[model samples]
Target: MTHPEAHKSHRAGWLRAAVLGANDGIVSTASLIIGIATASATQEYILLAGIAGLVAGAMSMAAGEYVSVSSQADTENADLAIEKKALENDFESELDELTEIYQTRGLESGLAKQVAQQLMAHDALGAHAKDELGITDTTSAKPLQAAFYSAVTFTIGAALPLSLAWAIPGHLLVISVAVSSLFFLALLGGIAAKIGGASITAGALRVTVWGALAMSITAVVGNFFGVATQ
Candidate 1:
């Protein structure tokens, strides 16, 4: 099987993460708006809730993505630092370690040793970083970049449903929001799954199931509250 190396992997991986975060943000926030709208709440109250959900969800997603990506970046940096020191102070041992690693992969002992020696002689740190440490040529982390894209894409996706609900009237508003939001989520899942070389049906099914659950539970709660107060 083709290892599907990093340069291509990076784009698809980032696309998947962005789609996941944005789709969740959109679907959950839209479902909240739908649930509240179904509660027979006045337009103003529903709109206020939608606005609040949008702002809170977007900011929360941004902060969470930032923290998660930062953690990954920190770990990679730590690995790089440790590796740099090993290469500097214990070069021979490090070289032996790399040679053995190549042998384990598939190379014969003599060939592994020769390959390791050449790699080290050419670029010791890079070779070890990829083979030994699992860091690679094209998959480095960029926390700020990830955070920005997630937040922006999420806000855009969420606005679709919120805007629809606000502009429409009565129970029809809720229907429009729910149907459109589900369609968007399913489309996102299929596109992202295709990009990642995964199953479209699996992707669509997973997102649709979660969206259904969220909307159903929220709608039930809203209906109960509506009945209790009336």
Candidate 2:
């Protein structure tokens, strides 16, 4: 890949983090706001609930991502340590074990043996780690990093609609949030696609469509309750 593309993929991790974080922010926060709004249209109450939701939601996302990713990182570290010890203790046996793994991947007997022989000569530790242990393309669990990214992304997403509600007329509150949320979702989809090297048009279409469906369902529920209560 070119320099710019490599830069983008490096940013890809952040992009993925943002997408997951923002998506949770939008859906959960929107649902919470709508549910709270249904309970009472009082602007103060809605605003209060939105603020509380933002803080709680962000904290929840951060804590959850950190714990999960950290656990994965721990497990991977443990596996790597064990693999290293096994290599140090029993070199020949480990070499044979690596050969069997390649055989399972459908290499002919002689070819597999040659591969094992050459790979062991080149880097015995790498060979056994890749074949026997299944930890080739490594991905570390970045719990703290993920948590920070998630919380920030979520806060940004959640704040958009809440700010719109505050700026617009109270009577127009719900519609504004609905419209702005769709706009953000579409923007998010396009950004996500571009980051992942996917078709932006398709990504935008799918996410916006789903956002519409979600908002519509909630609207139906809101109206049903609105009428029933009256």
Candidate 3:
């Protein structure tokens, strides 16, 4: 008996949402804390802002992912419904369409027709959904799953910087939170990339660069405002 090969494609749906959520959580919360601190806000105010950012960001990410993925799922279901109706109305035509699809993918016409016939007989809608509409169990949209992952991961990620801010006080709070947040971001990127079978270094660098930029810009704005107010 041959062992089945492991694949990462199945992780595509949740992984996208998780990585996006975590990255946003860390970057946004940390940036908010850093900006507040740079503006000479008290430690209490900085921590408060971090908490608010965490809660708001997590909810925003969850809502955004849910709505977007739900739209995709709706479109997919609509397509499948249309395909089902066509299959019901003209089974022979649908069979011929599948056969032509297989033929275009390199199978000989006769073999393609035979394969299509067998597949349609086994599970007509499934065969059409996969081959014709390009929707598979692994690749299909999942709004609830996406929303849950995003919300949970974002909360976890945002908690890191918030905890650091709470623990570290005084002038060092800004530097400590900034540095630690970058490390967290890099670690998250590497883990996500490794799991998805991509380049770890590239992924880590990609998130780190953007995180740093966001923090920098926010800091500048905060400092400008602080100076203007004074």
Q: Residue-pair clashes per candidate, as listed?
A: 0, 0, 0
lDDT of 3 by residue, 1-230 (tens): 99998789999999999999999999999999989888989999998899999999999999999999999999999999999999999999999999999999999999999999999999999999999999999999999999999999999999999999999989898889889999999999999999999999999999999999999999899888878877
TM-scores, one per candidate: 0.92, 0.79, 0.98
Which run of 10 residues does model 2 get worst, by summed lDDT?
4-13
lDDT of 1: 0.83
Q: Candidate 1 has what TM-score?
A: 0.92
| Displacement of the residue 207 alpha carbon in candidate 3, Å | 0.7
Top model number, TM-score: 3
Candidate 3 wrong stretches, greater than 4 Å: none
Q: Distance from true position, residue 116, model 3, in Å? A: 0.2
Which candidate gets the maximum lDDT versus the true structure? Answer: 3
Off by over 4 Å in 2: 1-13, 38-40, 100-127, 130-138, 221-230
C-alpha lDDT (0 to 100) for residue 79 of candidate 2 = 83
lDDT digits (tens) for residues 141-166 of candidate 2:
56778899999999998888778766
Model 3 — TM-score against the truth?
A: 0.98
lDDT by residue (tens digit), candidate 1, 152-179: 8888888888888779978688778888
